[model samples]
Target chain A: MNSQPPAASTETSYGEAIRAGFVHLLSSHREVFAIGQGLWSPWYVGNSMTDLDKLFGKARVIDTPVSELACTGAAVGAALCGYRPIVIHPRMDFMVLAADQIINQAAKWHHMLGGQAIAPVTIRAIINRGGEQGAQHSQALHAWFAHIPGLRVVMPSSVADARDLLVASVLCDDPVLYIDDRWLYERKAVLPAVSERPLAAEGPRVVRSGTDITLVGAGYSSWLCEQAAEILAAEGLDAEVIDVRVLNPFDPAVILASVSRTGRLCVVDGGWRNAGWAGEVIASVAEALDPRQLKSSPRRITLPNAPAPTSRMLEADYYIDAGHVAAAARTMLAARETAS
Target chain B: MSHRHWQSELAGLADPAQYTAPLVIEAAQGTRLMGLLRSMLVIRHTEDQIGQLVVAGLARTPCHLGIGQEAVAVGVATQLRTTDRVFGNHRSHAHFLALGGTPTSLIAEVLGKASGTSRGMGGSMHLFGREFGFHGSVPIVGATIPIATGAALAAKLDGGDSVAVAFFGDGATEEGVFHESMNLAAVHDLPVLFVCENNLFSSHLDIELRQPSDRISRYAEAHRVRSLTVDGNDLLAVEAAANALITGIRQGAGPALLEAVTYRFRGHVGPNEDIDVGVHRRMADVSAWKRRCPIKRLSEGLLAAGIVSGDELAALEREVVAKITDAVTLARRADYPDPSALHDLVYACRP
Candidate 1:
């Protein structure tokens, strides 16, 4: 944890920053088009597509019918034919309907066709959770998209990344799955300007530096780690927070280096507990670090392997937040204390 | 209940040799009948050579032969230019040759040579030749229908008269992408031509068992798109249907569907036509269908129209045979790719 208190930033939330990013992207590239259902209506409140259809007209900001498979396939086809299309799946669960086009066609075209084509399309699939919505609506399926080889999966944890990563994903010359979590939309932070160009390829960034423990988080989980870092700081327990923005081409050098120093790690993610993206990160650190490097065993804070419940209390207990992350770090510290 | 109606409506097209009447070309000069004849002949000879390779154990891949259905490809390809995008499915040998793809490259691809269309990575099922405007082909049925629609949308965005064509089988119509693509094309008024080759059987299972009807144009009609069902064996009919559709598509009228009723001469895959797994195709049906060969029909038409005599037809066959023989020899001699190149073509050359 830092010696000084964190500085106060602007009041713009991640959702607002993301919407401005869309306006910038649409105005920047004439070939770029954003197509999905309910984009122009209030149903897409945090969609970052406010007034895009009016500004760019219906042709550019295409309002498609309720067809995920056809629309996703159309985006892939459009990308192949020299168009940069950002296809939005307002809810990530419905993206399963388009698995054929996403996994088989969009992801495989470049490699299977022997580089004869480039599907430079960006799929903006949102992970909406925390509500009383039932099983169908509240699921984080980023791990499945990360499992594919030809795709670049990015989970933005901060408002800056939400803006910059969208810009980067659209500019990338390959199929990119830009996974956004709705929980982080209300979190406010300083973001890049709409016209500012960010790095095309960014690795994991160490947001908060510490030495006692290395806390890893992806998307909303990264924000959770930041909150946990504050709690750990109050207890005089220094904890390092690393935001894993890119999941597919994950370079664990930073995590391994932090683990080598801290000798303990806690992975926080919004995915299933068993066989999740957090597990992959934890396993990588365990494999890369020596056995003696760890003062205590690694820990993972993820959702239980069950469908989301409709009750408010059940929803509260199911999701992992800042308090859960801090508790996980404390448990690791207690175990090390007991052993010592 | 609709099943019975579908059966009666499709009963007229159930026979394999429904339109086996030999074509007698009346006037061949102004219509470019000679080029059409040559194109069909090339496709027939190409598939024939591929069958020989599969039987000789030289081609080590699934060679889906469209031996009896060459006219469907040649007809559609005749009306297409180098800029018009076209996609094909597993049974795409005739589609490749008809689009002016050289025999040497295609045969080399089948033989897994380094100089093949996919650089030996995609055997016979996956083919890619952008120069000739055959964008790409995959083994997955109906996979390219939406992709072709995307290409057509791209053409429209580019503000050009170019159109996109998707060549698939009757089996592909059963896939959701086919219907989705038709709807998308119609909604966007994309310049796309959905060409369905209704060969009755979809890999040994008859269309009757799979669908309520044998005709695929009905699906197009459901999408409110213009469609035409033609005798796939007759080159003129297929071309005329495709020409009208392509012209309208170019004029920004919208998407159109052309269902070419044809039959595969050989089994679903490989050389032998007599061997089938389920509901064996009667030998009489196979023989009668062969009598309606696209190449033979065009040849007879050309001969009758005084375009070429019997001796000329025989000489053309000999010439095609010689070219195929040379392509095979070259393909056999072509080198296989180095093992280190396994990961090379997976991505484009990064700039």
Candidate 2:
């Protein structure tokens, strides 16, 4: 788990991690399959859909047309047909064009249809490096889905979590919004033999722990927070780190428990400030906590409310790095001193 | 209920009338009979209003009004129950209302009011009344057909007899999923009724211009499923076909197709039938098609049969108009969904 991209195998950059989980999903469920835009169209721009075409064959691993709306509608079609489909979100932006399918149809069909229709569809969205990709390409917009009721949002930070969540997603009865971080694509680790069912496929999991400030993060930011926590421990502040595997059905009890124990909180999120997932987490922590729980006001470190710049120099200026997260935690602690 | 023939369900795509043109019905009688008429009328008026509403700027969503297409819904839905599932396409007002969904909720939905069928989030095209067994309707043509077919497969797994229905237009036949849905539904012996309202148009392009034959039954025939084509304007015909075929399906007759040939008086979308896309449209054909109005034709037969007098028919019209008016008022007065609720519906609620 370094900055070096893992050797690209016969699989595409995104495919190395996806291959294991998708293969597991296919073998386990007679009804489950992986499908999406480039599913057969030859090029998987963001999804590591390499060798998938070979594994599942053309019928199951379908590559569709440029019609995102039609493609999404087809997913609903496939899903309603008792097929558990892992739908490709191609880009964070493509979903916007197909909102009617996901937001209006697939997401609400079960509840709206009075449980008569269950859309057990999984959407895989990739948030590539949010900084250099500019406005559209760089968004870690799990916050866009942070409020839907019927969806389970899972953003895995490790290879096993990545692989296991895919299998678990296929197994779950509800629809899942599974986000893969392109920034971490080709990043490798030893995957656990992913259980078909583990308790937290759509819930949070603690990656590492400490006793000072609890740092919660998801997807790419989860790894970033880990590095930031290391810097914090070196600074003599023991910050615990929690990987919020899921965003919407967020594990508030676990987060609050950590906050109750540590008596402080700092969140690092890749999505932009204001309306991002970090803001919601901050709100959730604030809403859940009373006067009894804290030694400091909770802090959130995220990309500033500005367009992602293309140049490396501008990215360093715009996006949040480990140094920024460590700085924010210290600032929260320092501000805690004045208030006390 | 014993269906030894166990016919292929999609054959109706080929032989349109075989499944829908039945002159036989048994022991059908009061609120149940009247309920059928009421549903047809409600479909007519609601769609008529939807046309006006779209032009009036009250409803912004694309509205596929099934105005001249009421009998098919009342006919098909009469044979269905709450436990059974039904799905429709862009033209689903009749499908939803006939299945016993509220007019106020539908109107509110068209108006984007909180009390709408989808809680004001999904407009007229995407109606979901899961409690009443109306699963959903999609704007994407033929999208929900396969889903309904799939749901039927699920119901089969659960055992016992429950049928799934997919109500689409002739235009949807062009989509590959329609055939896929039919093939899958038949091959699995899933108990589903594919009801196609062939009004001879895909939006503005007439089916004649788009298709080689005026008939859509051939596709259903190609699939080797049981097929029925009927004058969708005839309620008795629609009802008899649906009733007879539905019992067979529920008795494990497998999949079947009932193609009801009907027309929508309105445009491919919104209220105006000729919303300026006059390319292949003939006002004359629209007029000719209007004469085949399912409601009018039914009333004429009822009147000829002395089912009621002119005064009684007048009274019924008044009641339907009143209901439409009330629905409009309520929908207009109803609130828009909370902007916050926008985020709430996409996922299942969890603690």
Candidate 3:
């Protein structure tokens, strides 16, 4: 197993890395255009698209009106006509308005045209959770988009993955849905001078490795798993942290190998538990590995099947955090002891 | 036919008779006019064949026939170059045929044959022909409208006068995407021509029941897009309106909406008139609109001007029938897609 440390040369926030990545792509490629409702506005788009209009001019960095469906459809059309268009949906909730274009036109165009036509449109949908944003605005609709056939769904957890994945998705020739959680925008991590990860990559990555139990997550949950691994380390439990970055072209080889060695698995997901992405992971691992691999049944840590509550207390209880992940890992370890 | 019943049905819209004026071929480009007439006849005969196939239960797909709406497509296509992008809604036989997509490929697609335009993948509602600049058509109400707008944006960015045309129904105007697309095109000054074939019925429901007024071009006006409303069945009128709008779009004057007030001779789905579906579609209005048939009106003008004799028109009809017959036979003989080929084209992996 070639489990080496991430090549970190400097430290940076996730938001900074994403912003820098876009800036670099826009500078290098003349065909790429950053367009959305509040791309130029500081308050609406945070530091991700900050000063992009000033740097690349308004034509390349367009600030569109509050028209998600048309704008997103326009982006798809532009991509079909040989322009690499990056559309920011700012919130996943609003992206639902443009689902027809994204799912029907962008995703199916290549196949519908018998591979003669392709839409290289990257939709950066931000998962803005918590803080009384209410049910409508606060949603992680990664599983919904992942259910689609011809879409490349990716959730980057760390600053490095965020930077590299964004660049890869922009350059990829297929329709890519790059999901990023707003909560992790401030999270800081060491930055590699060059991409330490795979360039034309697909599948999960082992952020932290161990022998006992495996904690699998994607996007926000992946970061939580990393923190949970730290807490588990203090508790003398060696839990492996695997971030399933690309969910659509998801290769289960790395995950299956990790599970076969570790013998215990705890899948963490930001979305609801029932029929969620985490369930797919757990199901695949269970179907692959032998029962005599000799450990406890895999557990899935996810939100209950309910709309996002507005109250801060309910919000806190509703979401799955690092502590929750740590507790799930400990429960799996305890089950292992009982089985032994 | 009860004129009172028809009048009540078409109460708000302008007089349908005024728009359906008998075409005049006097000094009109005789060869081009004759070509347009032949194209209309081909569409009419092709649709008639489809209607028969649908009744025979040979065609299992849902076919939205544009029987009486031939002039709108023929007229618009007259102004379009092979390089300009054109998109269509569920009913798009004329749009494809007018753009020179082979009748055999279209019939093959409907029959789910490998020789189909979409390679038997997308049956009737979904059509694809990019070589003729007829970019794929979707069944979704307002789906391809914005796509055409984006294509126009791309054309502008590519530094050319290439125009993007979206052919949709008046029913699609109810979709927010239509309004958004119009606004986006207007805001960007993109070279897009929004063509709304207002057949006045959204499936089974009448436009009277759907909107306050039958004039859908008002929505185009709301978006600040220059629009022209004409008798869609009148080939000359539609051709003139489309020519002006397309010319402006090519000159970079921005997006324009051409509302062609036309009617479908058949049902929303399948071949029948669809009045049996308990909907409020007036039989009298159907009869009245029949007199304003685009093909009949254009032929009448051609005949009056002696541009095309009755014998020539008969020969043209025979030729079209033979052509469609041959296409149907070829489509029937074509193979179904290979079973192992099912996994292909889901994602276009970059080579």
Candidate 4:
């Protein structure tokens, strides 16, 4: 299913890379279709799916009614009938309305059918945060889905993965929850031609190399870790950055190796503190490694366990950014130095 | 205008004795009518065997018996093809059997054997008979309505005449997704038949207490889809309505609804008549509903039409009982799935 590789890489934003993925999949595959709310409207879904309906025809790129459960369940049914469909939920918070179809139906269909059937549907849930959206509008519930036994959760942190992971997800015969962050849409990179690969081959990658501390994150949190690594570099503390691309069926080999070498760990997560993806990452590392190997105890920078406040002033304290990650990394190093 | 109540118009139909008249058998329907009767008998006997299994403690799964609601499934299945997809709710044994699913596979599934339809992973609530056009069934009420709608969308996109069917109960209409699916199917003009087997009760709660109206086809009207309500105990009525609606759907007439106002002789979940659970249900209602059994009415019609003799009807019952007994014996002999391969099917292709 690999398309022809481009002769040279082209500069592309994260949002455009996603569009490129959709374009490539729709152009190449006949069975692929996209269905969801606001798929045709740029104001709702941003530049990611702009004019896709016009490009691929309204039949293939369906802009459905504002029924989350029905649309999601419809996409699943289409998938069962030999169609590869991508159901886009404009916001992760509202996607909760269709949690039954996603968690119970899509995820369990193959297993419950004893491998006789497959719901090869990709659910693209975008995390829209900040700008005083508050509470119901802002959430990153990737942990809840990653906890499911039958789901494959992918969070694309880099521009190349933004496009490539979307391609891999739709082509995959299993249901995948491909989460993208609105915060990382502006980040640009030179993306190569779409080189299709199995989703199983993708996992955590060491984006930056260092020896002092390891920064682990996925999606926007991975972007924060990259920014934090740059800040730590200026402060004479070299930090290794690991992007956990696939949250479900998470391969801790890369992160374990990075933390084993760096001797310190600080995870940056966009979700809440308790029972969060950050905690799962920490637990995975803790389960595999001995305590004596680390220079200091692991630290995690996450949102407070409270609903997002609407006030602009409180928003600054509510959301986790690069500065918080940098500060947390600095404190972890400082604590290790004091102990030594 | 003051709103007219459904209880008054529907009172005669639900009286149990009202629709006991034998079916008007046409010369052309002799073979077809007997086939329908055989299908309903198969479901009744198969579920009867399952009921016995539940009583004997051999069936550990939660078995929702559609004992008296067999006509709805058999009637609808007669109009469907192998290419036309069908989905069922929790009470789906009748649906499966009517769609040509073997009793052995279903019994094996309930017994947690390797030969089960779901390979013993899913019990009575979850079943898949893809060859018979049964996509699957789940215990979640109204969950498959949208799924069948989606399948209809697929059928439309595939440029085929095949339609999709969702068999749900009156209780499922209360779910928001059901309305959403109806609206979506109607809006898209998708070929889907929404079959509501209005069994008068959602679990232990009666339809009167659950919804303002006892008639469920009004929801279809709310979505602007063509609909018909029929006496579910009458096999011919359901068959005729399903035939018209399914034909219309296949001919690009978009979605339709068939509300078969039926009754389950058994309780909500198991084989027992749950008259003690709620104030609305009683021994009288159960006995009255039993008198209006779909199998009995159809058999009486066949006898009245001289299509079969009294000895033939008795002999047919014995034949069905023996076949079900053999299926159960074989299902019991089937081995259980290996515990070592518990995680074999977690994902189609594990990452």
The candidate maximizing TM-score is 4
Relative to the real complex, the DockQ score for model 4 comes to: 0.78
TM per model? 0.94, 0.63, 0.95, 0.97
Residue-wise C-alpha lDDT for candidate 4, range A151-244, written one tens digit per residue? 9999999999999999999999999999999998889999876888999788999999999999999999999999999998998989999999
Expressed as tens digits, the lDDT of each residue in B330-351 for candidate 2 is 8899888777665544444333
**What lDDT tens digits, residue by residue, belong to model 2 across residues A1-340?**
2235445342233345676677777766767766556666545544466666776676567665455555555556557656777778778777776666667667777655334456777878777764466777766778888677677788888877778787777666677788888777776665544576642335776788888788989988888888888998888988888898878676677888888898888888887888888888878888888847888877888888877778888887877778888888888777766887
Model 3 ranges with Cα > 4 A deviation = A1-9, A193-201, B1-21, B274-281
User: Which residues of candidate 4, in runs, are more than 4 Å off?
Assistant: A1-10, B1-11, B275-280
The weakest ten consecutive residues by lDDT in model 2 chain A span: A6-15
Kindly report the fnat of each predicted structure, to 2 decimals: 0.52, 0.16, 0.73, 0.78
Against the reference, the lDDT scores of all candidates come to: 0.83, 0.74, 0.86, 0.90
TM-score of chain B of each: 0.95, 0.89, 0.94, 0.96
What DockQ does each listed candidate score? 0.48, 0.12, 0.62, 0.78
TM-score of chain A of each: 0.94, 0.89, 0.95, 0.96
